[model samples]
Target: MKHFGGNDRDDDVRLKLVETLYNQPTSLMMAVLTGAMGGITAAIATQNPVITAVGVALALTGIVRFVLYYRMHRNALDHDARKLERIFEAGAYAFAGLCGLLAALTIYLHPPGAIQVLTVSLSLVYGVGISARNAARPLIATGQLLLVCLPIAIAGLLAQDIVYAILSALLVLVFAAVVSVTLNLFRILRDQITAAEVSARMADNMRRLARTDVVTGLLNRAGLNHDLVELLMALPEERMLAMFWLDLDKFKEVNDTLGHPVGDRVLAEVAARLRAQAPDKAAVARFGGDEFIVVAEVGDRFESERLARAIAEDISRSIRIDQRRIDIATSMGVALLPNDGHDIDTLMQSADLALYHAKVGGRNQVCFFDTAMTRDLVRRKEIEVELRSAIQRDELSIFFQPIVDLETGRIRSFEALVRWFHPEKGELRPDEFIPVAEETGAIITLGNWITAQAAKACAQWPEDVTLAVNLSPMQLRAPGAALGILTALRDAGLAPHRLELEVTESLFLDDSADTVRFIDELSAEGVRFALDDFGTGYSSLHYVNKYPFKKIKVDRSFVSGPNAGRKSDAIIRAVAGMGSTLDMDIVAEGLETIEQVQAVKAAGCTLGQGYYFSRAVPDYLAAMLLAQERERDEKARRA
Candidate 1:
């Protein structure tokens, strides 16, 4: 079977052929009047009863043929394509036969003077009509010319008189002239038709390109806009339209880690699946990067929900690209027309809010638009504004929680945590505002401030006491990250060895090469790096060995609670044992209870931090705690 793409050449030929048939009526009517006049003139010039009677009969015959030709042309529109072509072919043959008959009669009757001249003139004029009218269908034009002129020329060649011989040569010349002119005219017509087809094709291609997403082969934002408007305009009184806004979860992670070519394949597969899953009447488009929109007509909310669910199931299926199988999930936001919104822009905004809620509610599910979700966005906006001003107004402050040495009961290090002292809302933890900061790109500014403050505080601490600061994934992946950290150390007059940068496994998933390389640079410069919140993300034995890190912090999730506590103990033991062989120090974080501290110590943890030591406090209080510890150590040494 042939591919589904259209063929333009065939269409051009067909259009021109039909046009040739359509043009015949106007030219055919002219031929009738001229032929009748020529017959009358021949009769008058001859002045013979037999000649007049024959001329009158021929005129009447011409009139009959004229009526037939006119009827065929008029009825062409009512006929099917094949039948119309057949009608045009019959008309051409009939006209050509009439011309030949007139020529033969003129020659055989030997009409006198002006009558013979008029008969010959009729044949020449009809030759022009054949060439003009049938140029588009050159075969028809050629056959008609042969019928009109060839018979007359052959008959003239059989005559004995010199004048008759000259007339025959003239007739032959007329045939050649018609043939040559019609052939060239046909070529021009074919070229013009081809040009027109090309022009039309180019216009269609331009529109397709403008409205298509090149990567996914789906409709782009412009196409979506056009389709949405069309959907709105054509809406029925009872029917409702639903819009599904689907965004791929962790798509950037795939692109950043796997390269754009792999990312492009993923996007294409996504579009193909979405299109395949969508209903025939649905209009699917690529609304944003790794985001798709489906606007489908539905009878009710149940139908809309079913469609969204099916789309989600289809999109979530695994895709294999470049011999690597990747599983990606889509979070969909649905909004129904006339219920959620009436216009395209309003529906899109409503859908976006729903999508936001879906992401917030934990991805890999669908959410419908509701008025209540507006408050969540409003709070987000408020947080965004306050976060931007957090550092400038000195609303941001760092608190230090000590990482205690398990063997010596000494403060080994302090992890600096940022607390937003909101004048109205009191103290806010990283959980409440960190995501917003990262989303708003305010984390970089805030992180930089925290790093500087942490470095300055660690500088005042005892030489053995290092400070660990959790580095946001945003800060780690951004440009100038290494320089920013080094600048912070220099400005704070702190040694690189006195500060440890704590990074989560999330950073590795984002851009492993860049993140690993940046950490390598800092580690080479005598700065320490540790995997923070270890086992909470995509942690692996391979990753632990590949990266140059001095310490691993066991995430709190495995360290506390019921049966989780036993599992945490087992996990802690396994990690500490593995860390020992790798020459890595293990720090058990979020140790709240004395039992938690004892459990980590029994598990061979070298360091521990949580409420067991002290909750994170201001720099002055943390300094005093360290001072008290240092003074106690000195007195014990003196004793």
Candidate 2:
């Protein structure tokens, strides 16, 4: 077996193999010193004028070659491949051989007294230089040793001098032993180099994997940011960058209904389409999930908008996967550099904001970010940034709205609404920043904080009046959703039966199995479940049948607006009847007017919550309101 069993054919390994052999600087330096020494030794050992003349000429030739090689090395680029290494090795070994031949001739032509000692000394010194400098590459050391010491050993053997023959035999043995030892050294160096190469390849693979999106073979968010920075650095002064943030509309519904396999195929198809349509200079990156970014340098704002529109038009085409036809549409947002903001982060944010507007205002189109949108986004970001700190600093508080039992005119429960006091912006309402918090993933932290705080508040409330808190879809999707509530209830000493966790019908459009399982697990713990904003989502009845909810809160939209087919009161009555059949209580939302209140009560609605009872009140005010209502009831009983 080949002892060194790696790919010796690798150019990097091959180049490393010859490093010591063609060390130009070392080779030239040694050649100059050895050439001068050889000439001087020849002159001193032999008075023969012919040998002296030839030695000087040999020294001059070696100096000239050294000068030439030095200039060549100086002119070469740092990355110049070692293509001439073998040729340079040949020249170096040939010059060393010539110097050795000159010295060998001197030994042959020497005058009698002390000359033999001087000549042998010259050969031994050269052999030492070879082993010392070139031993790292065994072949280089072997070549230099044979050239410098072999000729002298052969000359001594031919002289038939007993002492010279004994020394010559010893020199030959020493040369052979060094070649073997340094060859082992070369093998070690080669093995180390091969191991380094393997490590380098592994690092490169890891870097590529980090930058790539596994699903679509596109640059992920990190890679996109890196490429964007590189592109900006390479861009011309007059050119501006445009970022197009593209989101596949209704993608969540596709994942929910058709399944992730089809959703994945759709995402892949979208990437393929974008790759085909993107400009040569544009970079297309998958920003995870159904989002993608296409960035390019634009000559003007019109070109930026034009590119965005073209991309939207192409991606909106119908796609078919496994015989399931899907009509897909994309919403795109465009932001121009310098005009939007010069940095990659600001530009991407602007593009994302514009994409949001396009999606919300009837998707399948492109929207360029206007100045107004920038201001609006800036405000939203400010709120989102502060909202993170607000939750941590205990600046968020829960305000409860009374859900009244309309028949008895008594408050059955109080629903908790999170309110934030922005130190600079005054009291900010939930509608302004709740969605932002959800989008930024701050909701997870805020949700936990809300649950903990609300649990504590429930501990302080009357036992019969349960504390109801709205849950974001993110909260319910967590695996520990039920566990978190159970833990909080246990910590606060509140009975699970009195705590109502409210969720909207939109939860039904999510991963249905997980959602139902979450609700079931929590309901099993005696926590009451309410389907809030019931008719605002598709398939409310489907979700109602799937989960055991104790109450359904009618969405104010259908209750407040006149029914397209009949009076709004009729829809309310129908929902109330359905709730009755399910043994669930029905509460009408957005009952601001006394007439709307009377209408829902007359329609058989058992519970109601809206401005008609009171806008959501702070915890202290809610306590007072409940107290007043109790006192009034007692006075009525006495009367």
Candidate 3:
């Protein structure tokens, strides 16, 4: 018989085959009953003492085989598969030999009689049974077949009668045919088992892939949910689980300054650091881009807090990738089970809310969940919802703040600022609702309305005085923003040159091609641009040289703050000198007193905008101011 190649999988299949033989004992029972019946019947027919003794011996042997098989089955785990198979093979051979001896004796003692026919028939029955029953182990089946049938065939040939000689030849052919059949059955069984094992292995691999994060090799969101549920179910009363939600601070800057490939490397390194720093037996998972979650059991709130801070400190360390040192920090939010939340959804929500507070408070720190944070979040959400409908409800209005020419003391332009009149909340400033608008995508609609309104108001003023409207970075990146601005200008009958769009330095952080194209296209159309809050962000000079900026608005921090000093004066003078060389207007923002105004004018600023000149006023008041200025200029011209 052919055997399988002896690999581990093949060995497993072989063991299963051997186990099948022992598991089904119906064939073994039948073999024993047949042997006893045949032995008793032959003994009565022969009436010989030796034949009677052989009959008793055959019955005893069958009983012994049954008892041994039962014992092996009972203690199967105590024996190796190969050892058990060897013992089975030995018992089978012994039983078959006894049957063969009985058949041979009967044929040799009788002369073509009923007694001879009965014993030989029993031997043939046993041979057929072995072939079918022991097909899983074909070698054992073949050996049993030959041992039980060959002796009968020889005894028939020794009778020397032509009929008996023909029977012997037929028995030899049957043995060959049965052996061939058993071998084919073994091959078929083995192939089926091998295919099942392969399929099972493939399914397991697919399951693992589904749960794993491809880049970081950590559990993904779905896997985290699964483990969290199991942990909650098995949680002990004395133990509490802490869920630490971590977000990499300013991670988008890494991807924007570098590329996604380098960003991915940074994320992978962060994952490694988190895994190494996490408490033992903690479940770490990647919750999505630049976010991760760690869950572990701790004794008390202090331990949970300590662990969260430790993880944050470890992750704050600098990471080196591809010969570049990248300094990164993490903000973590901790939520405890049975204290902060009782279920997965509530715990996750609490952790996320805490994370928001951590980022707001400052990065590289840990924040625990509290009820106050939830109230603040709910209030912010309400403000966002109300701000969406403020414009349609006539609750939104634009205010104008004058930007004065320092040398002439004449208003050069008025920057349009938005204000909201909430019916229930009395009145709300831009800072209260604008951030919510930006987050909820309401800024796009609000910004467009502001543009149209400001343009119309500016058209009513003297053409020499332009309108300055601040643009959100989100508004600039929005598609068709340039077209929308042009549409507003065309509708309001305002010339493009009389509209100045002020953008912050943060706009250039990502180096977006679309933003550059937007600026370039608008500049070509004669619209003006100013770099607002210039010194507060990254690398202002690079952007000043790259874009066609008509003005540079020095951030208020450098003009009038408690920290303002000689260093501030130096920075202002340097920027003013640069603006002069570039032929761009330099505006000093946040001027509150005459001294501050004079200091900025002496520092080389061409323009100043702040409360010292005028606070933001409504359109009617601004138009009146512009009309009065025009009257004054007319008198001066006449003089």
Strongest candidate by lDDT: 3
Query: In model 2, which regions exceed 4 Å deviation?
Result: 1-7, 19-31, 44-50, 75-82, 112-119, 135-137, 381-396, 401-415, 421-427, 435-463, 466-639
Residue runs of model 3 more than 4 Å from their true location after superposition: 1-9, 23-28, 39-80, 158-162, 229-237, 375-434, 437-470, 473-639
- Per-residue lDDT tens digits for candidate 2, residues 567-624, read 6667788989998888999998888888878888888889989988989888888888
Candidate 1 lDDT over residue span 1-639, tens digit each: 121111325744555555566765666667767767776776787776765765676577667766766675666556565565566667667667666666766676676646666776677677767676777666677777777777677667666668778877886777778778877777777777788877888999999899999898889999988887888788788999899999899898899889989999999999998889887768899987888999988999999988888989988888988789899999889998888887777888788878877877888889999888867585675687799988888998999998899999999898899999899988787887898888857899889999999999889988988989888888987888999999999999999988898888877775668887788889888898898888776887777877888999988877764446666688889999999998999998778888888888999899998887899999999999998998998999999
Per-residue CA lDDT of candidate 3, range 221-252, in tens? 87898888888887789999999999998798
Q: lDDT score, residue 83, model 1?
A: 60
lDDT minimum window of 10 residues, candidate 2: 1-10
* Pairs that clash in candidate 3: none
Top candidate on TM-score is 2
